[model samples]
Target: MTTQAEKSQQALILFAHGARDPRWAEPLQRLQQIVSKQVSGDVLVHQAFLELMTPSLPELIAHLVQQQVAAVTVVPIFLGQGGHVRRDLPELITQLSADYPQVRFTLAPAIGEDEQVLKAIADVCIAQL
Candidate 1:
């Protein structure tokens, strides 16, 4: 009987497909650490890669369940909606939901079109131009 409201107290999990270059993951991990620090609540932050790195989505979700979290939010750290975000992520959520029936989990949209992202890109373009 886990309602959406009850799930709000759960931890958040961000899924990122690791880059071939090791440095690529560093920025995302740093961002995660920053968010974990800034958010004021009983929340847990975790990172999982579709490729490379350790602790895939399933593993992280399993860990969250073991911790008896009220809910788990899976946010895809993707630039845009694609096959992985659109298809694969949904499939993973469905499977995870089935596996952990006691713990509620939610999937957030991809962070593709943020205002800050647009401004950052515009600044880069302006600098180049």
Candidate 2:
């Protein structure tokens, strides 16, 4: 069970590889907003990009730590366990966690290869069919 120490002022850090087209950020931002509203105990949400964004994951995590957040969950908003998710994110998380030991950090699995994702793709393909 996730205790309040792990729950209080919890932040969900959504990391996405940004798009040159600014509009691409919208859907993830919308999803973040929805989840932020639903989670219990003053859930805070932030978005960090692998590139083309002001705050990277390390920077965002540091900012959340400065806010004295009790805990945070880093969820990669990538489509799959691609190169960035497989390599960069883990290294970044490790470095940030080392720098800030007080704040607890949880790294969730990437939203890749899930049934829901497959269904979504199937639905899109079905439309073409």
Candidate 3:
């Protein structure tokens, strides 16, 4: 049973591959904060991990569904579309879609593949030369 307030919430989940070291998630946490501030009211941003961390994708999505978030956009904070991004993520989304029929889920491309991101990396490398 979704409340009227819950029906208006839209969420963005920054999905990343987790590490055993807690410090590894600092950057993503910072990203979540930045995104949260940029978005308008009724939009929420969150972080979820693939492994070696708490609140895996499924868990986060489940919570969001429970909260009655109408839509969710999942952005993979990964460098490339490797096995985890290509194989694992799709499988996870499929299961989540089946579980949360009312909520919409969208997957964004891996962050590194963006032209601006690649150019930034190249600029940094060139600066070191």
Best by TM-score: 3
lDDT (tens digit, per residue) of candidate 2 on 1-129: 976555447788888898788898999889888877888657788888889865778788778876669788888887788888889888888888889888788887787657787798789989997
Candidate 3 total steric clashes: 0
Higher-lDDT candidate among 2 and 3? 3
Q: Which tens-of-lDDT digit does each residue in 27-62 have in candidate 3?
A: 999989999899986888999999999889989987
C-alpha TM-score for every candidate: 0.82, 0.83, 0.91
Ranking by lDDT: 3, 2, 1
Better of 1 and 3 by TM-score: 3
Worst 10 residues of 1 by lDDT: 2-11
| Rank by TM-score (best first) | 3, 2, 1
Runs in model 2 with CA error above 4 Å?
Answer: 1-8
Every model: Cα RMSD to truth = 4.5, 3.9, 2.4
Model 1 pairs whose backbones collide: none
Supply the TM-score for candidate 1: 0.82
Error of 1 at 19 (Å): 2.9
Q: Alpha-carbon error at 82 in model 3, in Å?
A: 0.3
